[model samples]
Target: MNVSVSRNSSHSEPRSLLAGVLAVLVHLIFVAMLIFGLNWKDHPPEGMVVDIWTELPQPTREPVKTVPSKQEPKPVQEPVKPKTEPPKPEPPQSELPPEPVKSEPPKPAAPQKAVTTPPVKKPDIALKQKPEPIKEEKPDLQEQKKKEQEKVKEQEKLKELEKQKELEKKKELEKQKELEKKKALEKQKELEKQKELDKQKELEKQKELQKQKEKEQAIQRQREQEAKAQREAEAQRAAQQAAARNLVTNEVSKYKALILAKIRSRIVMPPDLPGNPVAEFNVTLLPGGDILDVRLSKSSGHAAFDSAVERAIFLSKPLPLPPDPALFGEFRNLNIKVHYRE
Candidate 1:
């Protein structure tokens, strides 16, 4: 078949195989120099066949002989000197024995003399200062804002001096209430001028008691007009002396009613005054009428009841004298007033 495969014939190794293609092209150049030394960057990849070699079935041959002998080697030993005396130095072994007595470490006490602290006088280092000029805080903040505006103008002049001392204590309490209302209007005009001078001294004492009661009523009407003109001239001389002494106008009116019932039975009264049962008073009579003035113009609290109304008006003294000397001035002004009403 004219075959030989030594190597390159454009790879397909068939043109009659040249020495098995030159051992497969020396194992494919040892696998392309181991893939270009493990492929750095060229792009030549794909050819894989690496089987190395193992198909063997022929290797057998044998025959050859020869013998000869010779020998050598053995020797070594040299120190030898006799012993005796220098062993006396064995006494130095007591060195560790000396350490056993380590009792001396306590000698450190002898170094204690360093306690002398007396040199401490070094405090005079007071020299580092010099830094002062920083005071302009804006003129101490404008003198603390002018001492807070002069403490707010002394608190607004103490609130306008406490509102002018409260308007001078309200004008001194309204001038003490207008001087106590002008002293109560001058004590009500001096009590209305002392009530008009007590009504002009009570109208001049009631006009002097009505002019002494009209001059005692015109002196009792001129003593009753001279006792009625002496009773009409003794009644015309008792009718011409009763026609020449024959006087019997019914026994001259029965002895003039028995001398007015004997002076009204002695006009009694006094058991302490106030009487009025008819014996009122004027019983005096005679040119010689005895009981002159038995006091009480109006008395009653008495000296024995005004001496029992003056012994009952002197027991009605010479009283029956009414033969009419014109009724003797009505018993000569004998005013009496006794009133008792059991």
Candidate 2:
């Protein structure tokens, strides 16, 4: 019964151990899937190309004409006119006084001759002038070509900056996924360790209960053994006491007969005493068989015979007794009857 109970208590299920193994297997499978499922090919981004075209300006032209150099001349000046000789004036103012005295007659004489005057002419000169010529302008082409080249270079730089921004964004996303995976693995390990601790505590409790039960059983067996020993000792003591009592009773009976014989030897009977006489006496003795008192309970009816029996008892002092002191109480006080025949 003890062996069966111990076996049942000692054995336990291995559930926690099996759970730990299963968790490890699940983690391994997840790692394998990550390795095979993800895309790892290296594919760089494609670059873009742009084209520009411009037209050049055309030049303009103008026509030329000639001018003439001819001119006209000026007119000449006119001649002067002649004058009539003044009638002879003169000579004669001194003699004119004599001529005035005869004036009426002189007028009639001048009408015979009348005087006349002539016309005049003008002079001329010649001169000329000349004409002037015209000029043209042109355009430049090299400065226009330099401005178009600078515009094309600026557009290429802007496209390169946009491509760099896209690459940085992709790298940030990959880093975030890796951090999440690490956190999940740590949580799984903590749960497995907690389960193992709980299993160990349960096993310790079972062992303590088994030890307490065994201790109680041992104490019960010890108590039953002590009770059996006590009952056997009591039975043996009662048997020994019964054997001692029977031996003392037998020794007392033998000493009683010797005491009677000693008293009978001292008796002296009267010869005229009638009939057979039986007298009963009560004797009281000390532990050492010394007589203390004696009384006749039944008399033989003859005074002389009774007196003789009393004197015999007084002579037999210090009666015989049993060897064992423990039997003395039975004989301390006794009743005996004596029969005398003649």
In candidate 1, what are the lDDT values of residues 1-342, reduced to their tens digit? 234444445467456577788889998999998998878857666676566633211110000011001110110001001111111222232333233222332232122112111111111121111111212445666556656754765575566557556655654565556445645654654564455446445544554454455445545655566577778778878877886345444444454455445544554544544444322344333465655554444445544444454555677566454454544554565544443333
- Worst ten-residue run, lDDT, model 2? 118-127
Angstrom error at residue 287, model 1: 30
Shift in Å, residue 262, candidate 1? 40
Off by over 4 Å in 2: 1-219, 269-277, 302-305
Give the TM-score of each candidate: 0.23, 0.37
* Superposition error at 54 for model 2 (Å): 99
Q: How many Å off is the CA of 4 in candidate 2?
A: 99
Top lDDT hit: 2
Q: Itemize residue pairs with steric clashes in candidate 2.
A: 75-124, 76-122, 76-123, 76-124, 77-122, 77-123, 78-121, 78-122, 79-120, 79-121
Question: Candidate 1's C-alpha lDDT?
Answer: 0.45
